[model samples]
Target chain A: MKRAFGVMNQHKVMNDQDVRRALARISHEILERNKGTDDLIMVGLYTRGVTIAQRLSENIQKFEGTIVPVESLDISLYRDDVQLRIAQPIKPTTLAADISGMKVVLVDDVLFTGRSIRASMDSLQDFGRAKEIQLAVLVDRGHRELPLRADYVGKNIPTSLEEQVRVRLIETDGTDDVVIVRSGDGNNSNG
Target chain B: MTLLLSGLGMVITLMVDVESNVIGSQNVNAAGTNRKHILDVDVLSEDEILNILDQTDAMSEVLRRDIKKVPALRGRVIVTLFYEASTRTRISFEEAGKILSADVINMSSSGSSVDKGESLLNTGLTLQAMGVDVIVVRHPYSGAPNLLAKHLPKVSIINAGDGLHAHPTQALLDAYTVRSKLGSLKGLKIVIVGDVLHSRVARSAIWAFTKLGAEIVLSGPNTLMPVGLNLVDGRANVLPPVSVQPDLDDAIRGADVVMALRLQNERQNGGYLPSLREYIRRWQITKDRLSSASKEVLVMHPGPMNEGIEISTEVAHGGRSLIEEQVTNGVALRMALLYQVSAGGYQIEEEHPNGQ
Candidate 1:
């Protein structure tokens, strides 16, 4: 199966095993940076990031033997897609956590244009005064309209604007795989 | 208390939120009967609405934090004639009547004498002799409440909703909802979406919201939104008029408030909309559609939501949805209206045996 987002031209073709390794690495980095999960939180961007954050929290629970709080956000109201195409987007859920004086990491599936991240950052402002906020993503696609970047990234895939990146996972797509796709025009192809 | 006898039922209630022109200014009875936008906030200045809501809040406390009863309106009898089947609005006035210690009588015409071809006029005249204080009425006809209010004397009329004409109580709850969320209604960009033509809440909301100095944008498919109803009796008014928008996204863009009225399926039969799927695809408050507005935008709906159809389940349940708050505010708003109409005229009596 193909990743929901196709044609991610990162360093190499990552299988499900490679994706798992990347998550573990990212999880370890989050654990090390925060020192401990004492006052730290992981917030996911609606549908996909929710799973990513939950998986990372589970990984952290293995060593700490305690669960870290993870919150899911439905940024439909804060999405950048209002005037654009009509898509039945997912609604996000949030957990009531006192975010003050805590480390917050906002997770998303893809980082394209960075507009979504900017919106997510704005959405979190209403919840409370957070001491610190960080952004993490699986793939950082570089055609950013907004001057935003992820603090933790699984991979940076630089590709033509037209190329689509697909990240497939068993938890979602029933298979684990990642690939970049052509524009089907034959002239514009991702190797 | 001075009682005026009439052929129709008489109702006694408090008077609140009555906006008359500049103090001592004369009302020149216009050329023809004018239709006032009861929900527009602009007709009433911001201060007026703020004052009303503040008063409404105080009146609300009487019904909410108390023992569900008030001596403020004792010795009053009000007839609740619900021509439509509804749970929320019907019970609100009933509760308001009982709370104020008024004799509450309900007449649902399903198996009543109305089925025997008795006109509304005859039933109203018959109820008049019963010595009622007020008539809280809901009728399917657009001008039924106003007609009843005109023909009847002694009894004040509280319009729960009159067809697609105006649902004043619902509008009051909407005003309460916006006030609860924003703490104020002045100078906000409020957009109303979905079936504007058939939704009385939309019509009433326009009046109440406009009265509070908020800008209103009526947005929906051209077929669903009938643009020319903002005037008093369909003529121009002193208030700022409602702006029309065919595109939902543009209407919601940078909007401070977005209220989605339910899409009535019956209008489609009258060439009002193309299809429900098309309407949802184009106008439903989708996730992406929400981001067009500023972060502070509020999403509201009068409940029994269509879920994924009119509004997505996610957005409806999301943090922005004020649906529950709207329902909660309904009881208090109706109570406030009742308090005003029922007890407004009740001045505390001083100890003067000869005054009576």
Candidate 2:
């Protein structure tokens, strides 16, 4: 799928196998942190985040023999920069499982600036009160604007302001790779 | 020369961006574009209608939440300027505005300055002066909302129902309801039965459904069909074929959606129709009549329904009926419209100093 922004030349940071291994490790880490996935419900931010959450749930199922419920979270309305962008089409936020008194794990693809995660956190309040909230991300690029950190991370690629980090999943983009895009080369091909 | 021109272009882009930010902070429409007035379905293209419905779908999810409210329109003032008596349309608009955390005030013609023979133009001007950001209008006369739009260009005007002209939101909600049930409107046969002559709902529905690629069959008695009804077409030929099927049974045949319009009791006294008894006998949407329609055909009614008059009670409350769903979607659809109107604008705790 096409990334939202313009891309220049791309460098593969993680391939298909690398993504699978990272997710498996993250799932294990989540189970370890939460003490075996009981009362754990996973909520994925829209687009790629939901897919990552599903993958984490499947891994949890495989390891703990427990089905972790996953729900999609759409934070388009809750974004702070809503007035700066062109009309943000509202997306469906579906949570079939109640998060009340359960440990809610928020999953996403690449965490940069942490604005989307912040908005997701604000939106999660309306669903129900979770016992605790945890953030899980596939890649954590260090540009934290809101003093937020993910509890789980797949990989951390250091990047500058001019670079764009994109995590492509097989379900959405028909490819499984994490790439860093450097600008000005005009290599604008989609991920 | 190329380098110099590119440098100039960058400077111009920066200037424009800065200019837009300064002005955008004043008017909400600066960030996004949405027409201030929605007087008719023709104002929205097929894509625009579809987008609003898509937004409505998202808004529907908000209804499912524990706290079914949003701060999207907080501090905005929405006035339901209703000239005619209404339950669904007025309450729906009010609920929608409240759901978005907007300060909504209600104004009906009966108890308001309108009863004193104050002109609509004057009433609209007064409301505009009162810092009303948007006016959801439902007037007995057709084109009242259009007049409000023409006179009050600053305040957003939404046509709730204006005489026989249009009930655009009803159409939108109905279309949303239909699409939710049938999945897609394209190539679907929608038979609109009863009182098409006097229904703004029917007119608006035709405009909306036709634009979305549904074939329309208008079914009613000759007296109840609009004059020059044959001329009815999608605003810009953005619609599929529209035909009049006087016979209700034939109209419903192979139909994917069977929409029953409310039969006005006033039409009987007006001599536009012979009698309510005769009308119901000939046109009531019974189970047997609907049997000829597609097996999975959906039923609908814009309510305050003369249940046994235009539609059989069973059919109105039947499993195939989307009547209640339409009411629910009505709130979401209006909320979507309000959100769209306020999209580019900044939310404020107080009225804009320059608000008209």
Model 1: native contacts recovered, as a fraction: 0.00
TM-score of the A chain in candidate 2: the value is 0.90
For all candidates listed, what's the TM-score of chain B alone?
Answer: 0.80, 0.84
Docking class of 1: incorrect
* Best candidate, DockQ: 2
Give the per-residue lDDT digits (tens) of candidate 1, residues B22-129.
Answer: 310111112111111122232344554455566556445444432344444556787888888778777777887777566889988788898898887777777877
Enumerate residue pairs that collide in model 2: B28-B344, B28-B345
> Per-residue lDDT for B103-179 in model 2, tens only?
99999888888889999999999999988889999887776776776567568888899877788999999999999
Lowest lDDT block of 10, candidate 1 chain A: A83-92
TM-score of each: 0.54, 0.82
lDDT of 1 by residue, A164-184 (tens): 666665787787665566554
